[model samples]
Target: MSDTETLNKLRGVISKLARELNTTATSEGLTPTQASVLGLIVFRGPLGLTELAQLEGLNPTMLSRVIGKLTELGLIQRDPNPADLRAIQVESTEAGRELSDRIKHHRTEAIAACLDQLPETTAQTIINALPALEALAQALRSTHN
Candidate 1:
């Protein structure tokens, strides 16, 4: 097959994978954006509004609305930033932590199921490619700045 044909097939696979992840998360009661924010917290720990906005590649106002909704639902909490004085840091509450874990477990199970269908060699290839995938993601993020 031509390179273009190969790329097109990969694109379809990526879209399907993304949608599967999204559906799995949605089944756990979080929109994609909310899930993304929760991921930032779980991965990077607490951050100020501006920092979270940058981390999520979103506008502060949009992040604020998401944070507000999460906070209203008792999933997250905001506290005064001691260092910044004027800024507030957002962190997951116990409920948020539990919810995040549940979502992660759901995603893990879904992915494990998909991997189970793959040949062992293909699954190993994916495991080996993870570091490169992470590097590519970092490079892509840097390019935006």
Candidate 2:
């Protein structure tokens, strides 16, 4: 395929995958953004509001709203940062971690089922392209930042 065609195909695949993941997350009572926030907290331990907003590429107000909802659900805890008493840090509660795990499990299962239906060679091709795909993602993220 031409470069344009390849780009279009990649875009389509990525968009579809995002939609699928969002649907799975929503079914678990979390919006994609909330799920992402929980996952980040689980992976990174804790993050201040400003840091989390930058990481999530969301404006502070929007991130605050999502954080409020998550806090209300008892999935995450917001505490004053000891080092920076003025800033609040957010971390996943036990319930949040469990929910994040469940969301991850569901997403993995869904992807695995789809991959299982693909021919071995095709699946291997995708596996082999992972590094390149990751690099592309990083490059995109850098540009966004």
Candidate 3:
């Protein structure tokens, strides 16, 4: 395939994978964005609203809405930031952590099952490309920042 064709194919595959993951997240009563927010909180520890907004590439208002929904669902809590009493800190609740873990487990299982169907050499090639893939992601993120 030409470079353009190859890029298009890669994009299509990635988009499909994202759709599948979104479907899985939706089944667990979370949108992709909500799941992502919970996962970030779980992994990064508590963060102030502004900080989380920056990290999530979201505006304060939108992030606030998302946080509100998550809070109502009991997946996250907004607490007063100790260092900055005026600012609020967001953290994943125990329920949020459990749901995040379950979502991750489902995603891993789904991917592993898909990879299992692929020929060993093909799967190994994809594994070997992980670093390049990560670099590509970082480069894209840098451009946005």
| Number of the top TM-score candidate | 2
Q: Report the C-alpha lDDT of model 2 over 22-94, residue by residue, as the tens digit.
A: 7888999888998988899888998998888889888988898999999999999999999999889999999
What ranges in model 1 sit over 4 Å off?
1-12
Each candidate's TM vs. the true structure? 0.85, 0.93, 0.90
Please list the C-alpha lDDT of all candidates, in the order they appear: 0.85, 0.91, 0.90
Q: Please list the residue runs of candidate 3 whose C-alpha ends up more than 4 Å from where it truly belongs after superposition.
A: none
lDDT of 3 at 24: 71
Cα displacement (angstroms), candidate 1, residue 6, comes to: 4.6
Which lDDT tens digits does candidate 1 get at residues 25-144?
688678889988987786677888888888788887889889988899888889998888788998988888888888888889988998999999999999999997788678778898
lDDT of 1: 0.85
RMSDs, each prediction?
2.5, 1.6, 2.0
> Which prediction has the highest lDDT against the true structure?
2
- Choose 1 or 2, whichever is better by lDDT: 2
Arranged by lDDT, best first: 2, 3, 1
Question: Higher-lDDT candidate among 2 and 3?
Answer: 2
- Write one digit per residue (lDDT tens) for candidate 3, span 34-131: 88888999999998988788888888788888899999999999899999999899999999999999999999998899889999999999999999
